[model samples]
Target: MRAALYFTPSRDSDLTLAAAEWLGRDPFTGESVVSDVSGSDGLVDAPRRYGFHGTLKAPFALADGKSLEQLEQAAAEFAASRCRFTVPELALGRLGSFFALVPARPCDALNAFAGDVVRHFEPFRAPLSDKDLERRRKSRLSPRQDALLCEWGYPYVFEEFRFHMTLTGSVPAEQFDDVEELLKTSFAAFTGKPLPIDALAVFVETEPGAAFQVQSRHLLVSAETEE
Candidate 1:
């Protein structure tokens, strides 16, 4: 099994429910949701398996001597010690042929938060297997990213990470605009709003080809309370 750290809205939040329905799966519930988009299942096939979330720490196997229970406790501790914040604005965007919800501008707080999560969990992450290393190498990576992959098991973290909640696999270049419009309309109620970043979730993939599901959620405590 592999585990990842992600940010997802509260289980019963309207945005969470809408995203689950649009993606056709709910990581929180481990159930399928019907979508109205034509070929919706096929369009979101890639992200559906992972459900609706933005990764903070990419997935990795547990390091030797680490137990899932221990990891859960550590994650909960991390969450409880950190303060919650909000993303000022979220907008629909196309990253190449894929679509996602991304912040309108870079936020230092968001970047620092993600970097902390990566570093905090590093000790518990097993090194990437050879096959996984080679698979990452297939993509042309910058010198820094290659180094990050070697050291952290995932290339997109820290400075290279751009928080995005993926919505589609890869649409054709010609279909990008249409897909974006479709998603914009579908997610109108949730898009361009201030999104809360109040909790961190641990998600687990039971096997190589299985869908990842939420194993637990940790609420962020107020910074004032930590004093």
Candidate 2:
């Protein structure tokens, strides 16, 4: 089974339903938008076999063939030292060829949370093979981008970062605008007030038949007090 860590909204966050709805539409409507833009013939969710959210850790195979309990224990330890974050207001945004709800205000807290998650659990990951490198090469990078990719698997990190609730798969050059517009129209309700990124939830995909459920989430708290 493959395991990944993700940040999910707390129940208190009003954007949860909106995020879920956008994800639901992504498989169907989003597939078309991405297909129209990129000319890539594919389903948006075959690999994920699921919808979307911000990826804290890209999916990796479970190490040592470890049991879920062991992985959970590792994550629990990591969460203990981390303080909770109150994610600020976010606005819908367009990335290279996709759309997401990006944090509208400054959120150093969220960035630290992401870096911490990567640092603490990095031991669980094995280096990416040639095959993985080739697959991720579709997007070209600038020197700065390359540096970020060397440090973080993705080119956008820290200040160069923008949090997005992913809405589609990689899009082709042609259809970007259409997909962005579709998402903007569909998810406008979620932008009313800044949505709090108040928790981190673990959603696991074990096998073909398994469903990724919200197994657990840790709450974010003010730095002055313990969470």
Candidate 3:
């Protein structure tokens, strides 16, 4: 089974609650948008899998047949020492070909946490196969992006990263503006007021093709409120 450590919103934060509302507004919001984008949606009214959450680490298969307990222990140990930092107010924004809500300010704390996740979870990543290499080559990678893929087994890490809470599956080019507007309007209900992010959540994928489920959450040191 493949597993990933992700950035989930706090249970009590305004943004977290808002995200749940968005997901409830549309089941598609609570699923792996990447998968839907990669496949054909021929089925009618299919319930989607997974939901809105920022990715701290991309998915990777367990190495050397590791046990889940071992991975959990490692995660708990790593999480215990880490305190959460406040995520500044972010708004709905566009990411390359997709749209998501991203941090408004460039945040070092976010990058630091992402680095920690990579370092902590490096032991579990299976070695990249030839197929993986081919897939990555097709990606339009910058120097830093290539470096991150080589070192971390995924692109968009460290200096080449931005934090995003995904809102929907792949939107076609024509519906792009409409979807963006819709998501923005939905978010608008939460943005004018304070929308704080203050926790890291762990979401677990149930099966090979299944969506992920929230297994646990961690609290961070709450940042002093910004005026």
Lowest summed lDDT over 10 consecutive residues: which window, candidate 2? 27-36
lDDT per residue (tens digit) for residues 123-166 in model 2: 77656656756666666777786676666565665666666666
Of the pair 1 and 3, which is ahead by TM-score? 1
lDDT of 3 by residue, 179-199 (tens): 666666667865534334455
Clashes of 1: 0
Predicted structure with the largest lDDT when compared to the true one: 1
Measured with C-alpha atoms, the lDDT of residue 163 in candidate 3 is: 77
- Rank order (by lDDT, best first): 1, 3, 2
Candidate 3 lDDT (Cα, whole model)? 0.65
Model 1 per-residue lDDT tens digits across residues 90-177: 9887887889999888978888999999999999999998999999999888899999999999999888999999989999877777
Instruction: Evaluate model 2: give its TM-score.
Output: 0.72
Query: In TM-score terms, which candidate is top?
Result: 1
Better of 1 and 3 by lDDT: 1
TM-score of each: 0.96, 0.72, 0.78
Which 10 successive residues of model 3 have the least lDDT summed?
38-47
